[model samples]
Target chain A: MPEPERDILGGYAGDLLSWVMGRASSGDVWVTIMSNLNIVAVASLADPACILLAEGVELDDGVRERAEVQGVNVLRSGKNVFRLCAEIASLI
Target chain B: MADSVNFHFDIDGDNFTSAGEASVMIKKLLRQMEFSPDVIRRVSVAMYEGEINMVIHANGGTADVNVFCDRIEIVLKDNGPGIADVRLAMQEGYSTAPDNIRSLGFGAGMGLPNMKRYTDDMRIESEVGRGTTIYMTVNV
Candidate 1:
């Protein structure tokens, strides 16, 4: 499935979805190790450019399908959380 | 829209995986109804927080959304351990959610505050052992 291309504005790192929803600006590339389906909801609500899953975290069960159906861009990183954040910062 | 449209959903609180289904459905509905992006985003985000709250605190609940010409009204009701202090719960950075919930990426205590920020009107009615009903409205 294809999602609308989003421009990367910046990056936000947080494990708490509610906090990220409150503070992360629209188009920010959200970075987190949390891999729950609820992340799709927060990303949809916040309108982030995409979600970066660090520390080799991957969602389970039907989550990937939900993310695709909801059209939330999710990128996974094999690197640890700190390294992923650093890489995202360099890009932004 | 001339006549009001009502959308009701049963939020499943037994599992964390399906928490935001109601909000997602509403977002699609509002979009198909040709609501502006701003209105749709505000309504959905506020209700999304309320939905998540229902699952986290109430174990399960019902969400009723009324879409009228002038505003969108969301009534979130849950039968669970009711809020002890509405004021304290409304405060930013104050939370009663256990550490386990926090590890799941919610329970940051910004739920109600964020809901209030996005909607034009909000009211909360909760009883200690009975239930909680929250009404939120965003003007079109």
Candidate 2:
């Protein structure tokens, strides 16, 4: 059996919205610096496979709660948004 | 075209984070109703853009979605300070949204153009001080 293709990468909240809506397939991971509940809204809109908060950013409690409810996998990274995006892109 | 359903939602302008809720629900409903992916995507994107606009500009509004066999119609009405220049507002990359909104990752001025791009048809009715109403349609 063949393994599924991976398209892991980091993105800016603004730039990622449209790409996620039109191009990002399900199961793709998204990294961003945004920390508001609107991040969750965009995530739900994009339906990304998972989300990673980079640049040492912290999400509000409300955002975490909602993401949990929606069954979206959330992660935090010590790296900056750009670094994380680069690392993920290398892996992919 | 014979069978049709209507869905209505009150967009809460107070909470920018909750702006796209209606679009999400509509997307799910369309999926359950077995709409084609293209149709679902187009409708959802267009409605989401409109919802965001309502929150960003209107302080909130009402959304009415009429789903028909052949097409889906979405009407977004808001009672906020209306657009002073429809032509300028329609121009891509032109935005009057405050700087704070752009910081939150929206107000790129792409909302209306993207809405128009995804939908089959669109119309805007507005009075500068009164409010604005937008109608969009997607073929199913």
The top-ranked prediction according to TM-score is 1
Backbone clashes in model 1? 0
Model 1's interface RMSD:
1.1
- List fnat per candidate, in order: 0.73, 0.32
Residue-level error in angstroms, candidate 2, position B138 = 1.4
Off by over 4 Å in 1: A80-92
lDDT of 2 by residue, A13-90 (tens): 324354345445446677777677766666666666677788777877788888776556678888976787777778
lDDT of each: 0.87, 0.78
Pairs with backbone N, CA or C atoms under 3 Å apart (clashes), candidate 1: none
| DockQ per candidate, 2 decimals | 0.73, 0.40
Which regions of candidate 2 deviate over 4 angstroms?
A1-27
Q: Which numbered prediction scores highest in DockQ against the true structure?
A: 1
CAPRI quality level assigned to candidate 1 from its DockQ score: medium
